[model samples]
Target: MSFGPFLLLALLEGTVMAAVLALTAVGLSLVFGVMRVVNVAHGEFFMLGAVGAWFITYYLPLPPGLAWLVALIIAPLVVGAIAALADVTILKRLKYDPEATIVATIGLLYILQQAALTFYGPDARPVEPPFSLRLQFPWFGYSGYKLFVVAAAGAILLAVWLFMTRTKAGLVMRATQVDMETARAFGINVDRVYAGTFALGAALAAAAAVLIVPIQQAHYLMGHDPLLLSFIVVIIGGLGSIRGTLIAALLIGLSDGVISMFFSPTLAKIIATLLVAMVLVFRPQGLFGARA
Candidate 1:
């Protein structure tokens, strides 16, 4: 293939990656923004989503399209419920102390990993795409499903944006994010908000996992890369800044995809890490983050 074709392929791949990464990183960013809790187990939630999808499709005696559709609806809800349960049972009890939550979430991460290994097994699993169509470009054809992933993720992000900016529930969440004490004083149930936020974050991760599972097999350990990349995106985008998170995800995803296409994945990671280092050194608040 010519360089132009290769580059075009790389760009499409990168856009797909950015779509998934944006969903995952936005979840991470939302949790930090609202609850000020760094969820180390966030990636595990993502892994669980893929696992959930696999389970749904495997045992459900339905058509492939219907099974995938069901998984898409159910996995996020299941993962979100799990996250909410954890918040209620663990983080809430700990008073959401930043340091304490970090340790707590780390523990949760291990527990979830082990649970997956025990039940889901160590083997990787794949989910069939809901559709199998290709769109022919000038130089090549691409998976219609991949394009759908991009569109679906973009729609979800937009819905989230609308929820946060337009809805009363969103207003309450924003209030809590601004100041929990003040929000509580105004009769907002801060505890419920916290639980909901955690659930929402986990749901976003799960949703992303479901979307990408067809492209990448589900495995117990698959969350590590997404987790690391998410942290990088959140850091570079400015913690809690949704717009920044989306932009940074695109930047990292595109660069990683292009570099991996031409060079090595390891080299791509190195460059991403280097970029993170530079961001930390030069603009610790992130590109779109407000001054502290």
Candidate 2:
């Protein structure tokens, strides 16, 4: 078999997949970066976003593109608000005991999962892709929709990078990450920062879900894979490191996409997990984790 077209296709697919992973993983990294808390229920936020996008598209009686736009903006903000509320009400009190926070988040995860199942049913729901922007890449012979995913994700990531590196709020966030007490002493409102960070992180995940729903559809348990992958990306990228998470996500996305294209997705996933394990064994702090 000729390897030319297949290789090109795999590369394109890998790029697209990497974008999706980056969108989902960055939020996980951001939350850890700010609060030093690992949220197990992060995936549910993604599911909510997917569901939100689905409903907006299905019942809003609007054009698909407009509906998706509404979902992308509204879902993230809504989910982010919920997360912010959770942080203030529950997580803030448990800041001193991270283990307790972890357990609480796990419990929250179950609650969200069950709630989704109860409300949305156990079956996977289909999400129709928008028809307005069917960009055709004849050279690649692939769906224009895939390219749109790549472009949209890339734009979002770039925007996030700018927000983190360029804005005043971003600097405060970084400072808080380094030392919350010090940040507070310097007149930073630690509580507000924490709440904002959680909201921002959760919002990012919701954005990813909105972007993905047109392609992946909505389901109650759909958060499982993204949750696992987000954790892996955080671990591999060095927990709380945005740059590390982006790099790790790209690596994992490329490997998963290319390997799955050539072999079985199961094998691809196994290899991905093994790679992360190998990284952990050699560098427990993660590839870009801050050294003690």
User: How does each model score on lDDT?
Assistant: 0.96, 0.85
- What are the C-alpha RMSDs, in order, of all predicted structures? 1.0, 1.8
Model 2, position 187, has a per-residue lDDT of 100
How many clashing residue pairs, candidate 1?
Answer: 0
Candidate 1 similarity to native, TM-score: 0.98
lDDT of 2 by residue, 143-217 (tens): 787788888888999999999889999999999999999999999999999999888888889899988887787
Q: Which ten residues in a row have the lowest lDDT in candidate 1?
A: 283-292
Candidate 2: regions farther than 4 A off: 132-140, 289-292
- Residues 1-292 of candidate 1 have per-residue lDDT tens digits of 8998999999999999999999999999999999999999999999999999999999999999999999999999999999999999999999999999999999999999999999999999889999999999988899999999999999999999999999999999999999999999999999999999999999999999999999999999998999989999999999888999999999999988999999999999988888888988899999778888
